[model samples]
Every structure is written in C-alpha cells, then in structure tokens.
Target: MKRFHVHVSVENLDKSVQFYSTLFGQAPSVVKADYAKWMLDDPRINFAISRRGETVGVDHLGLQVDSEEELLDLRSRLEVADIGFRVESQIGCCYARSNKHWTTDPAGVAWETYHTLGSIPTFHAREEKTSTAACCASDSGQAGTFNTRRETTRAKHCC
Candidate 1:
C-alpha cells in the first residue's frame, strides 16, 4: 500500500495544528514542538506540517510506501522515466528514519518516494557540515530543489 504525503511549512504550529485538526476532524497522530503529522486512512494521506522551514507554504510532496519492495518499484519507475533523482538510505528526518528517492518536477516542486523505516528522536537526525544550497544533487551535479537536508540553502525539512 502507498499513502500520499504532503508536507507544509507553517508560520504558527499551534494555530496550524488547530486548523488542520478541525479540518481533518481529528487530532494529529503525532505532534512535536515544531511539527505535527496526521495519518488519515479515510483520505489515505500522510499530511504533515512544520515550522522548520524558511518558506511557509507547501514544502514538498511525496508517496509513502508500506514496504521495501514497493519503494524499489517506485524507484524503478522513476528510473524508467529518465528523471534524475537523489537517494538517501536510512536517513532520519521528520522524526522518522526512512529510505527516500527525491526528484524535482517540471515546475520545480520536490517529489519524494520513500518507505519509513522507524521513528527518530529529532526532526532531522543527520548533522551535515555543508550548507544547504537550494535543492538536491541532480545527475548533472547541479543543485536541484527538494526539501531534504542536502547540501544547499539551509532550509530544514524531512522526507
């Protein structure tokens, strides 16, 4: 199974949480001081909000798969499409550990396909020494825009 994932960067955590909880008709399944997540079976979506990014809007979009096989299948499809992507294995972000394949769309929207491996203690677990440019590394070694904590413009988000 796969769940559609939407991550938004918000200005106020409490207000956004309140609004989204009311909109979803339920409290988020997980709430942190800087983040909240709602796993809605009705819509089959994994919606998350955070106050951790410089931009306060839709940060990135993704598909969360249930198993490694499904994740690999998605990767195969992306590869077949000939789109450049960056892979992060067992990386921790959004209070979870996941294996992610990240790519940017035509309009520069970041798209991630991943399988969560487990929970983590922090929003982003890796401590990269390099500055975040603006995106992930593409096949041309140029910066491509994705929300993962790659070496770019210091925008902090998760997969």
Candidate 2:
C-alpha cells in the first residue's frame, strides 16, 4: 500500500516527538539524534520531522510508493491529470537514492513523490555539491529557486 508522507521542520525535536507521539497515540518507528519518523498503520501515514533552527512547519509533503513501477504509475497519473512534475533519479538528497517526482500544489506547497532505491553514501562535500547543482538544474523551471538553506539542512539532518 502507498503511504502519504509529510516531513516537517521543528525547532525542538524532542518536544515535537512527544507531541506527535501523543497525538498519534504511539511512539515513532524511527528516531535519530535530530529526526523522528512514525509509520502509522491506522491512517497509513509516514510522518517525519527534523530539528532545524526555528522552522516549525512542513518541509515537504509526498507519497511513498512500494516500488519503482508504482512510482512510474503515479507519474503517469499526474501527467493524465495535466500536472507538471520535475523528475530526479539517484539524487542524494534527504539521505537516500530516491527517484522523485516534484511538483507544487495549488497552494504553492512543494510536494515530492518518491521511491527510495537505497541509502545515500557517506557525507562527501564534493559529491553533495554536485548533487545539489544537478537537482537545481532539474527543478529550476518547475519549482523556481530551490531553498538552499532547507536543502542543505535536509542533506545534513535527514540523511
């Protein structure tokens, strides 16, 4: 089954984790030093949060598919719906080898639908710099300017 995923940026990771755990009536499935994620079965949501300065809202929203075929199917459906998407493959952002379809909603919130192919390699400044440049080139027309701060934060924390 597909899961609706939401990643939020929070000022305090511990506080947010406690609040969300209470709200969801369960603890998170994954927790790192600066991040937490809950794989909620009842609502089928993959909710994640990262501690990043003072930001306290959605970083991005997305759908997580089970396979590459499902990801392609979603891309096809988006095309049929007359929606434009920016696609990326094997891009090392948010700590994974994700094939993602990026787009903005009517309200202008960025959305990413992705299937993570594998974990990203260890942190390498040159490699990350290259990936960031490539991702910008890919999404320039679709998302306008990529928020470098947020992208860098994701690279450091979420990965």
Candidate 3:
C-alpha cells in the first residue's frame, strides 16, 4: 500500500506543529527543531511541515510507497502517461533514505513518488558532504521553475 504525502512550508514551526497536532487529534510522530511529521494512518497521509524560508503554503505533494516494487509501479505509470519525470537513486532527504521520482503537474505543482528505505541522522543524508546543489538536482524544467543550473537555490522544503 502507498500513503499520500504532503510537505508544507510554514513561517512558524512551533505554531504550525501545534495547529496540525490539534487538527489531526494527535501529536506529530517526529519533531525536530525545524521540522515535524505526522504519520497518520486514519487517512494514510505522511504529512510534514518545516520552517524553511519558502512561500508559506503547500510545498510539495507525494506518494510514499512501502517498497521498491510499488515505487517502480508508480514510476512506470508516470512514464506511460508521457509526462516528463526524473528519478534520483538513493537520494536521501527528509531525515530518511529514499529513492524518488519527481514530476510537475500541468499547474506547476511538484509531485514526488518515493520509497523511504530507512531513517538517517541528518535531513540531507547522502554520501559525502552533500552540497545544496547536488541535493536538489532536478532534471530540466520538469520539476517546475527550479533547480536550473544557474539557480543553485536549495529547495525551500525540509527534504
């Protein structure tokens, strides 16, 4: 099975966490200084929030699969849909190790399909000291108007 994922960027992490916890009727499963996550099973959504300096709104949407096979299945469907997509192998982020496939909806909303393998100590858990440049290596313009070679702006979200 796969769970829906939503990452939202907020100005106040503490307030946002409190709001979400009350709204969800439960506390976040993981809470960091700058990030918090609620692994809710009732709605099966991997909801996360961060204190990144992005627009205070929905950051990105995603589908979190339980295994590589499920992740590949989603990837295959995206390929068959003829939409441009990019895959990052074992690119760790969000305090977990995950392989991700990224694409943008027609409305310029970014979508990620990933299978998180395990937890990591750092938010950007990659081999070597991951430069902000390498962590968000989106292919071409499929991932919206970001990750261009000239623009080394790191993703505003926690991941």
| TM-score against native, each model | 0.83, 0.72, 0.83
Cα lDDT listed for each candidate: 0.77, 0.66, 0.74
Cα lDDT tens digits for candidate 2, 16-100: 9999999999999777765678989889998888763235687678898889999989988877777766676665544456777
Winning model by TM-score: 1
Candidate with the greatest lDDT versus the true structure: 1
lDDT of 1 by residue, 1-159 (tens): 999999998999999999999999999999998789999999999999987766899888899999999999998987787776677777778888888887777776777888999998876665354533222232322223333433353234465
TM-score of 1: 0.83
Q: What lDDT, from 0 to 1, does candidate 3 have?
A: 0.74
Sorted on lDDT, best first, the list reads 1, 3, 2
Model 3, 1-159: lDDT tens digits are: 999999998889999998999999999999987679999999999999876545779877889999999998998898777766667777667788788877677776777888988888866655355243224454323432332322333354334
Model 2: residue 21 alpha-carbon error in angstroms: 1.6
